[model samples]
Target: MTDLPAATAASSRPDGRASPGLRARLPFLIPLVVLAVVAAYFYVGLGRDPHVVPSVLINQPVPELALAPILGRDRGLTTADLKGEVSLLNVFGSWCVACRVEHPLLMAVAGQDLVPIHGVNWREPTPQAGPAWLARLGDPYTLVGADPDSRAAIALGVSGAPETFVIDRAGVIRYKHTGPITADDWERTLWPIIQKLRAE
Candidate 1:
């Protein structure tokens, strides 16, 4: 008689389901690792200000500017234009919402006659857009130029629209303010810097 096969041991649980092994558990661990990485990334990022970016152009002489005036305007902006006073060189664009947000404050600054504000209208799809937006917002710039190709903007180390530089009387860039200038930024920080520069 053939020997009866010894009863095989059950690999599965009494419930008839296979026991989960390391391979089965690995997939669950992957998401926890990913989540941990993401959470740590945000935790580090939360401590830094997004607007305080580094620039190679800070404290450097103003780059050469031969940009033409925006549409419907006569004088263009030149490096010569930035000399002989404390001024704001604001790089902006009509399409940039942040520029619009900062315009009223600029208008107020212009209204006060505190400093000469110059503008670089950056990368407009149509030349008319800059002129039109300025007309609606009311031009605060003493001199406004078109930077359709971003030559001047790149030289100025511009990362985005609505970047304002505080230039000293000698055509030197003293301070660079990235992003829109709020009332507090103007009053508490920039205005004081300008006052100090003006005294010098």
Candidate 2:
């Protein structure tokens, strides 16, 4: 039988020193490094920030908006529909989980008579889903507009559902809330702001 060659001292690390050939394997570490970078990128932008939400509407007129009037009703909600009252323009959809969670807060808003609440149903897959969702949840909206295309949402810089934009009687967006409204927030933050705007 032919004798086979054994690993030399250079190839084997007896004293805890890897060979030069093994050092070349370090390049494979790049993938792990890349994954960490990508994870960090997403983590940083995870939370909501009003700065990123286009501030163009702040202290500016509400963008011109027209949407399918109403689900089965004669009236529709629009900028024109928003006339003569300080109100809340709630951007939501029936399918949105956050919107569902915020339902109680909305009902609370209604109870307080803080302001008229109008809904802008954004990018609803179907009109039926939106109205049905509202009907099931006990509709709080004074009027609802079907925005299946989300054009109005884009114009408002609405990144997600359950956002509340406060519009003055003059129809300018004054304050915006970016996530589900909480009990404390409805009282301490939102209600106070709405009252201030109303007073002004």
- Which runs of model 2 end up more than 4 angstroms from their true locations? 1-54
User: Could you tell me which residue pairs clash in candidate 2?
Assistant: none
Q: Estimate each model's TM-score.
A: 0.77, 0.72
Model 1, global lDDT: 0.91
1-200 per-residue lDDT for model 1 (tens digits): 13533332235554657768789999999999999999999999999888677887878999999999887888999999999999999999999999999999999999999999999999999989999998987999999889999999999989888899999999999999999999999999999999999899
TM-score of 1: 0.77
* Model 2 lDDT at residue 129: 84
Judging by TM-score against the true structure, name the best candidate: 1
lDDT (10s digit) by residue, model 2, range 63-175: 88887765776677668877678889999987889899999878877876768899898887876888788778888888888888889999888888888888888898898
Model 1: residues with Cα > 4 Å off, grouped in runs = 1-44
lDDT value, residue 50 of candidate 1: 85
What's the number of clashes in each of the models? 0, 0
lDDT of candidates 1 onward, in order: 0.91, 0.81
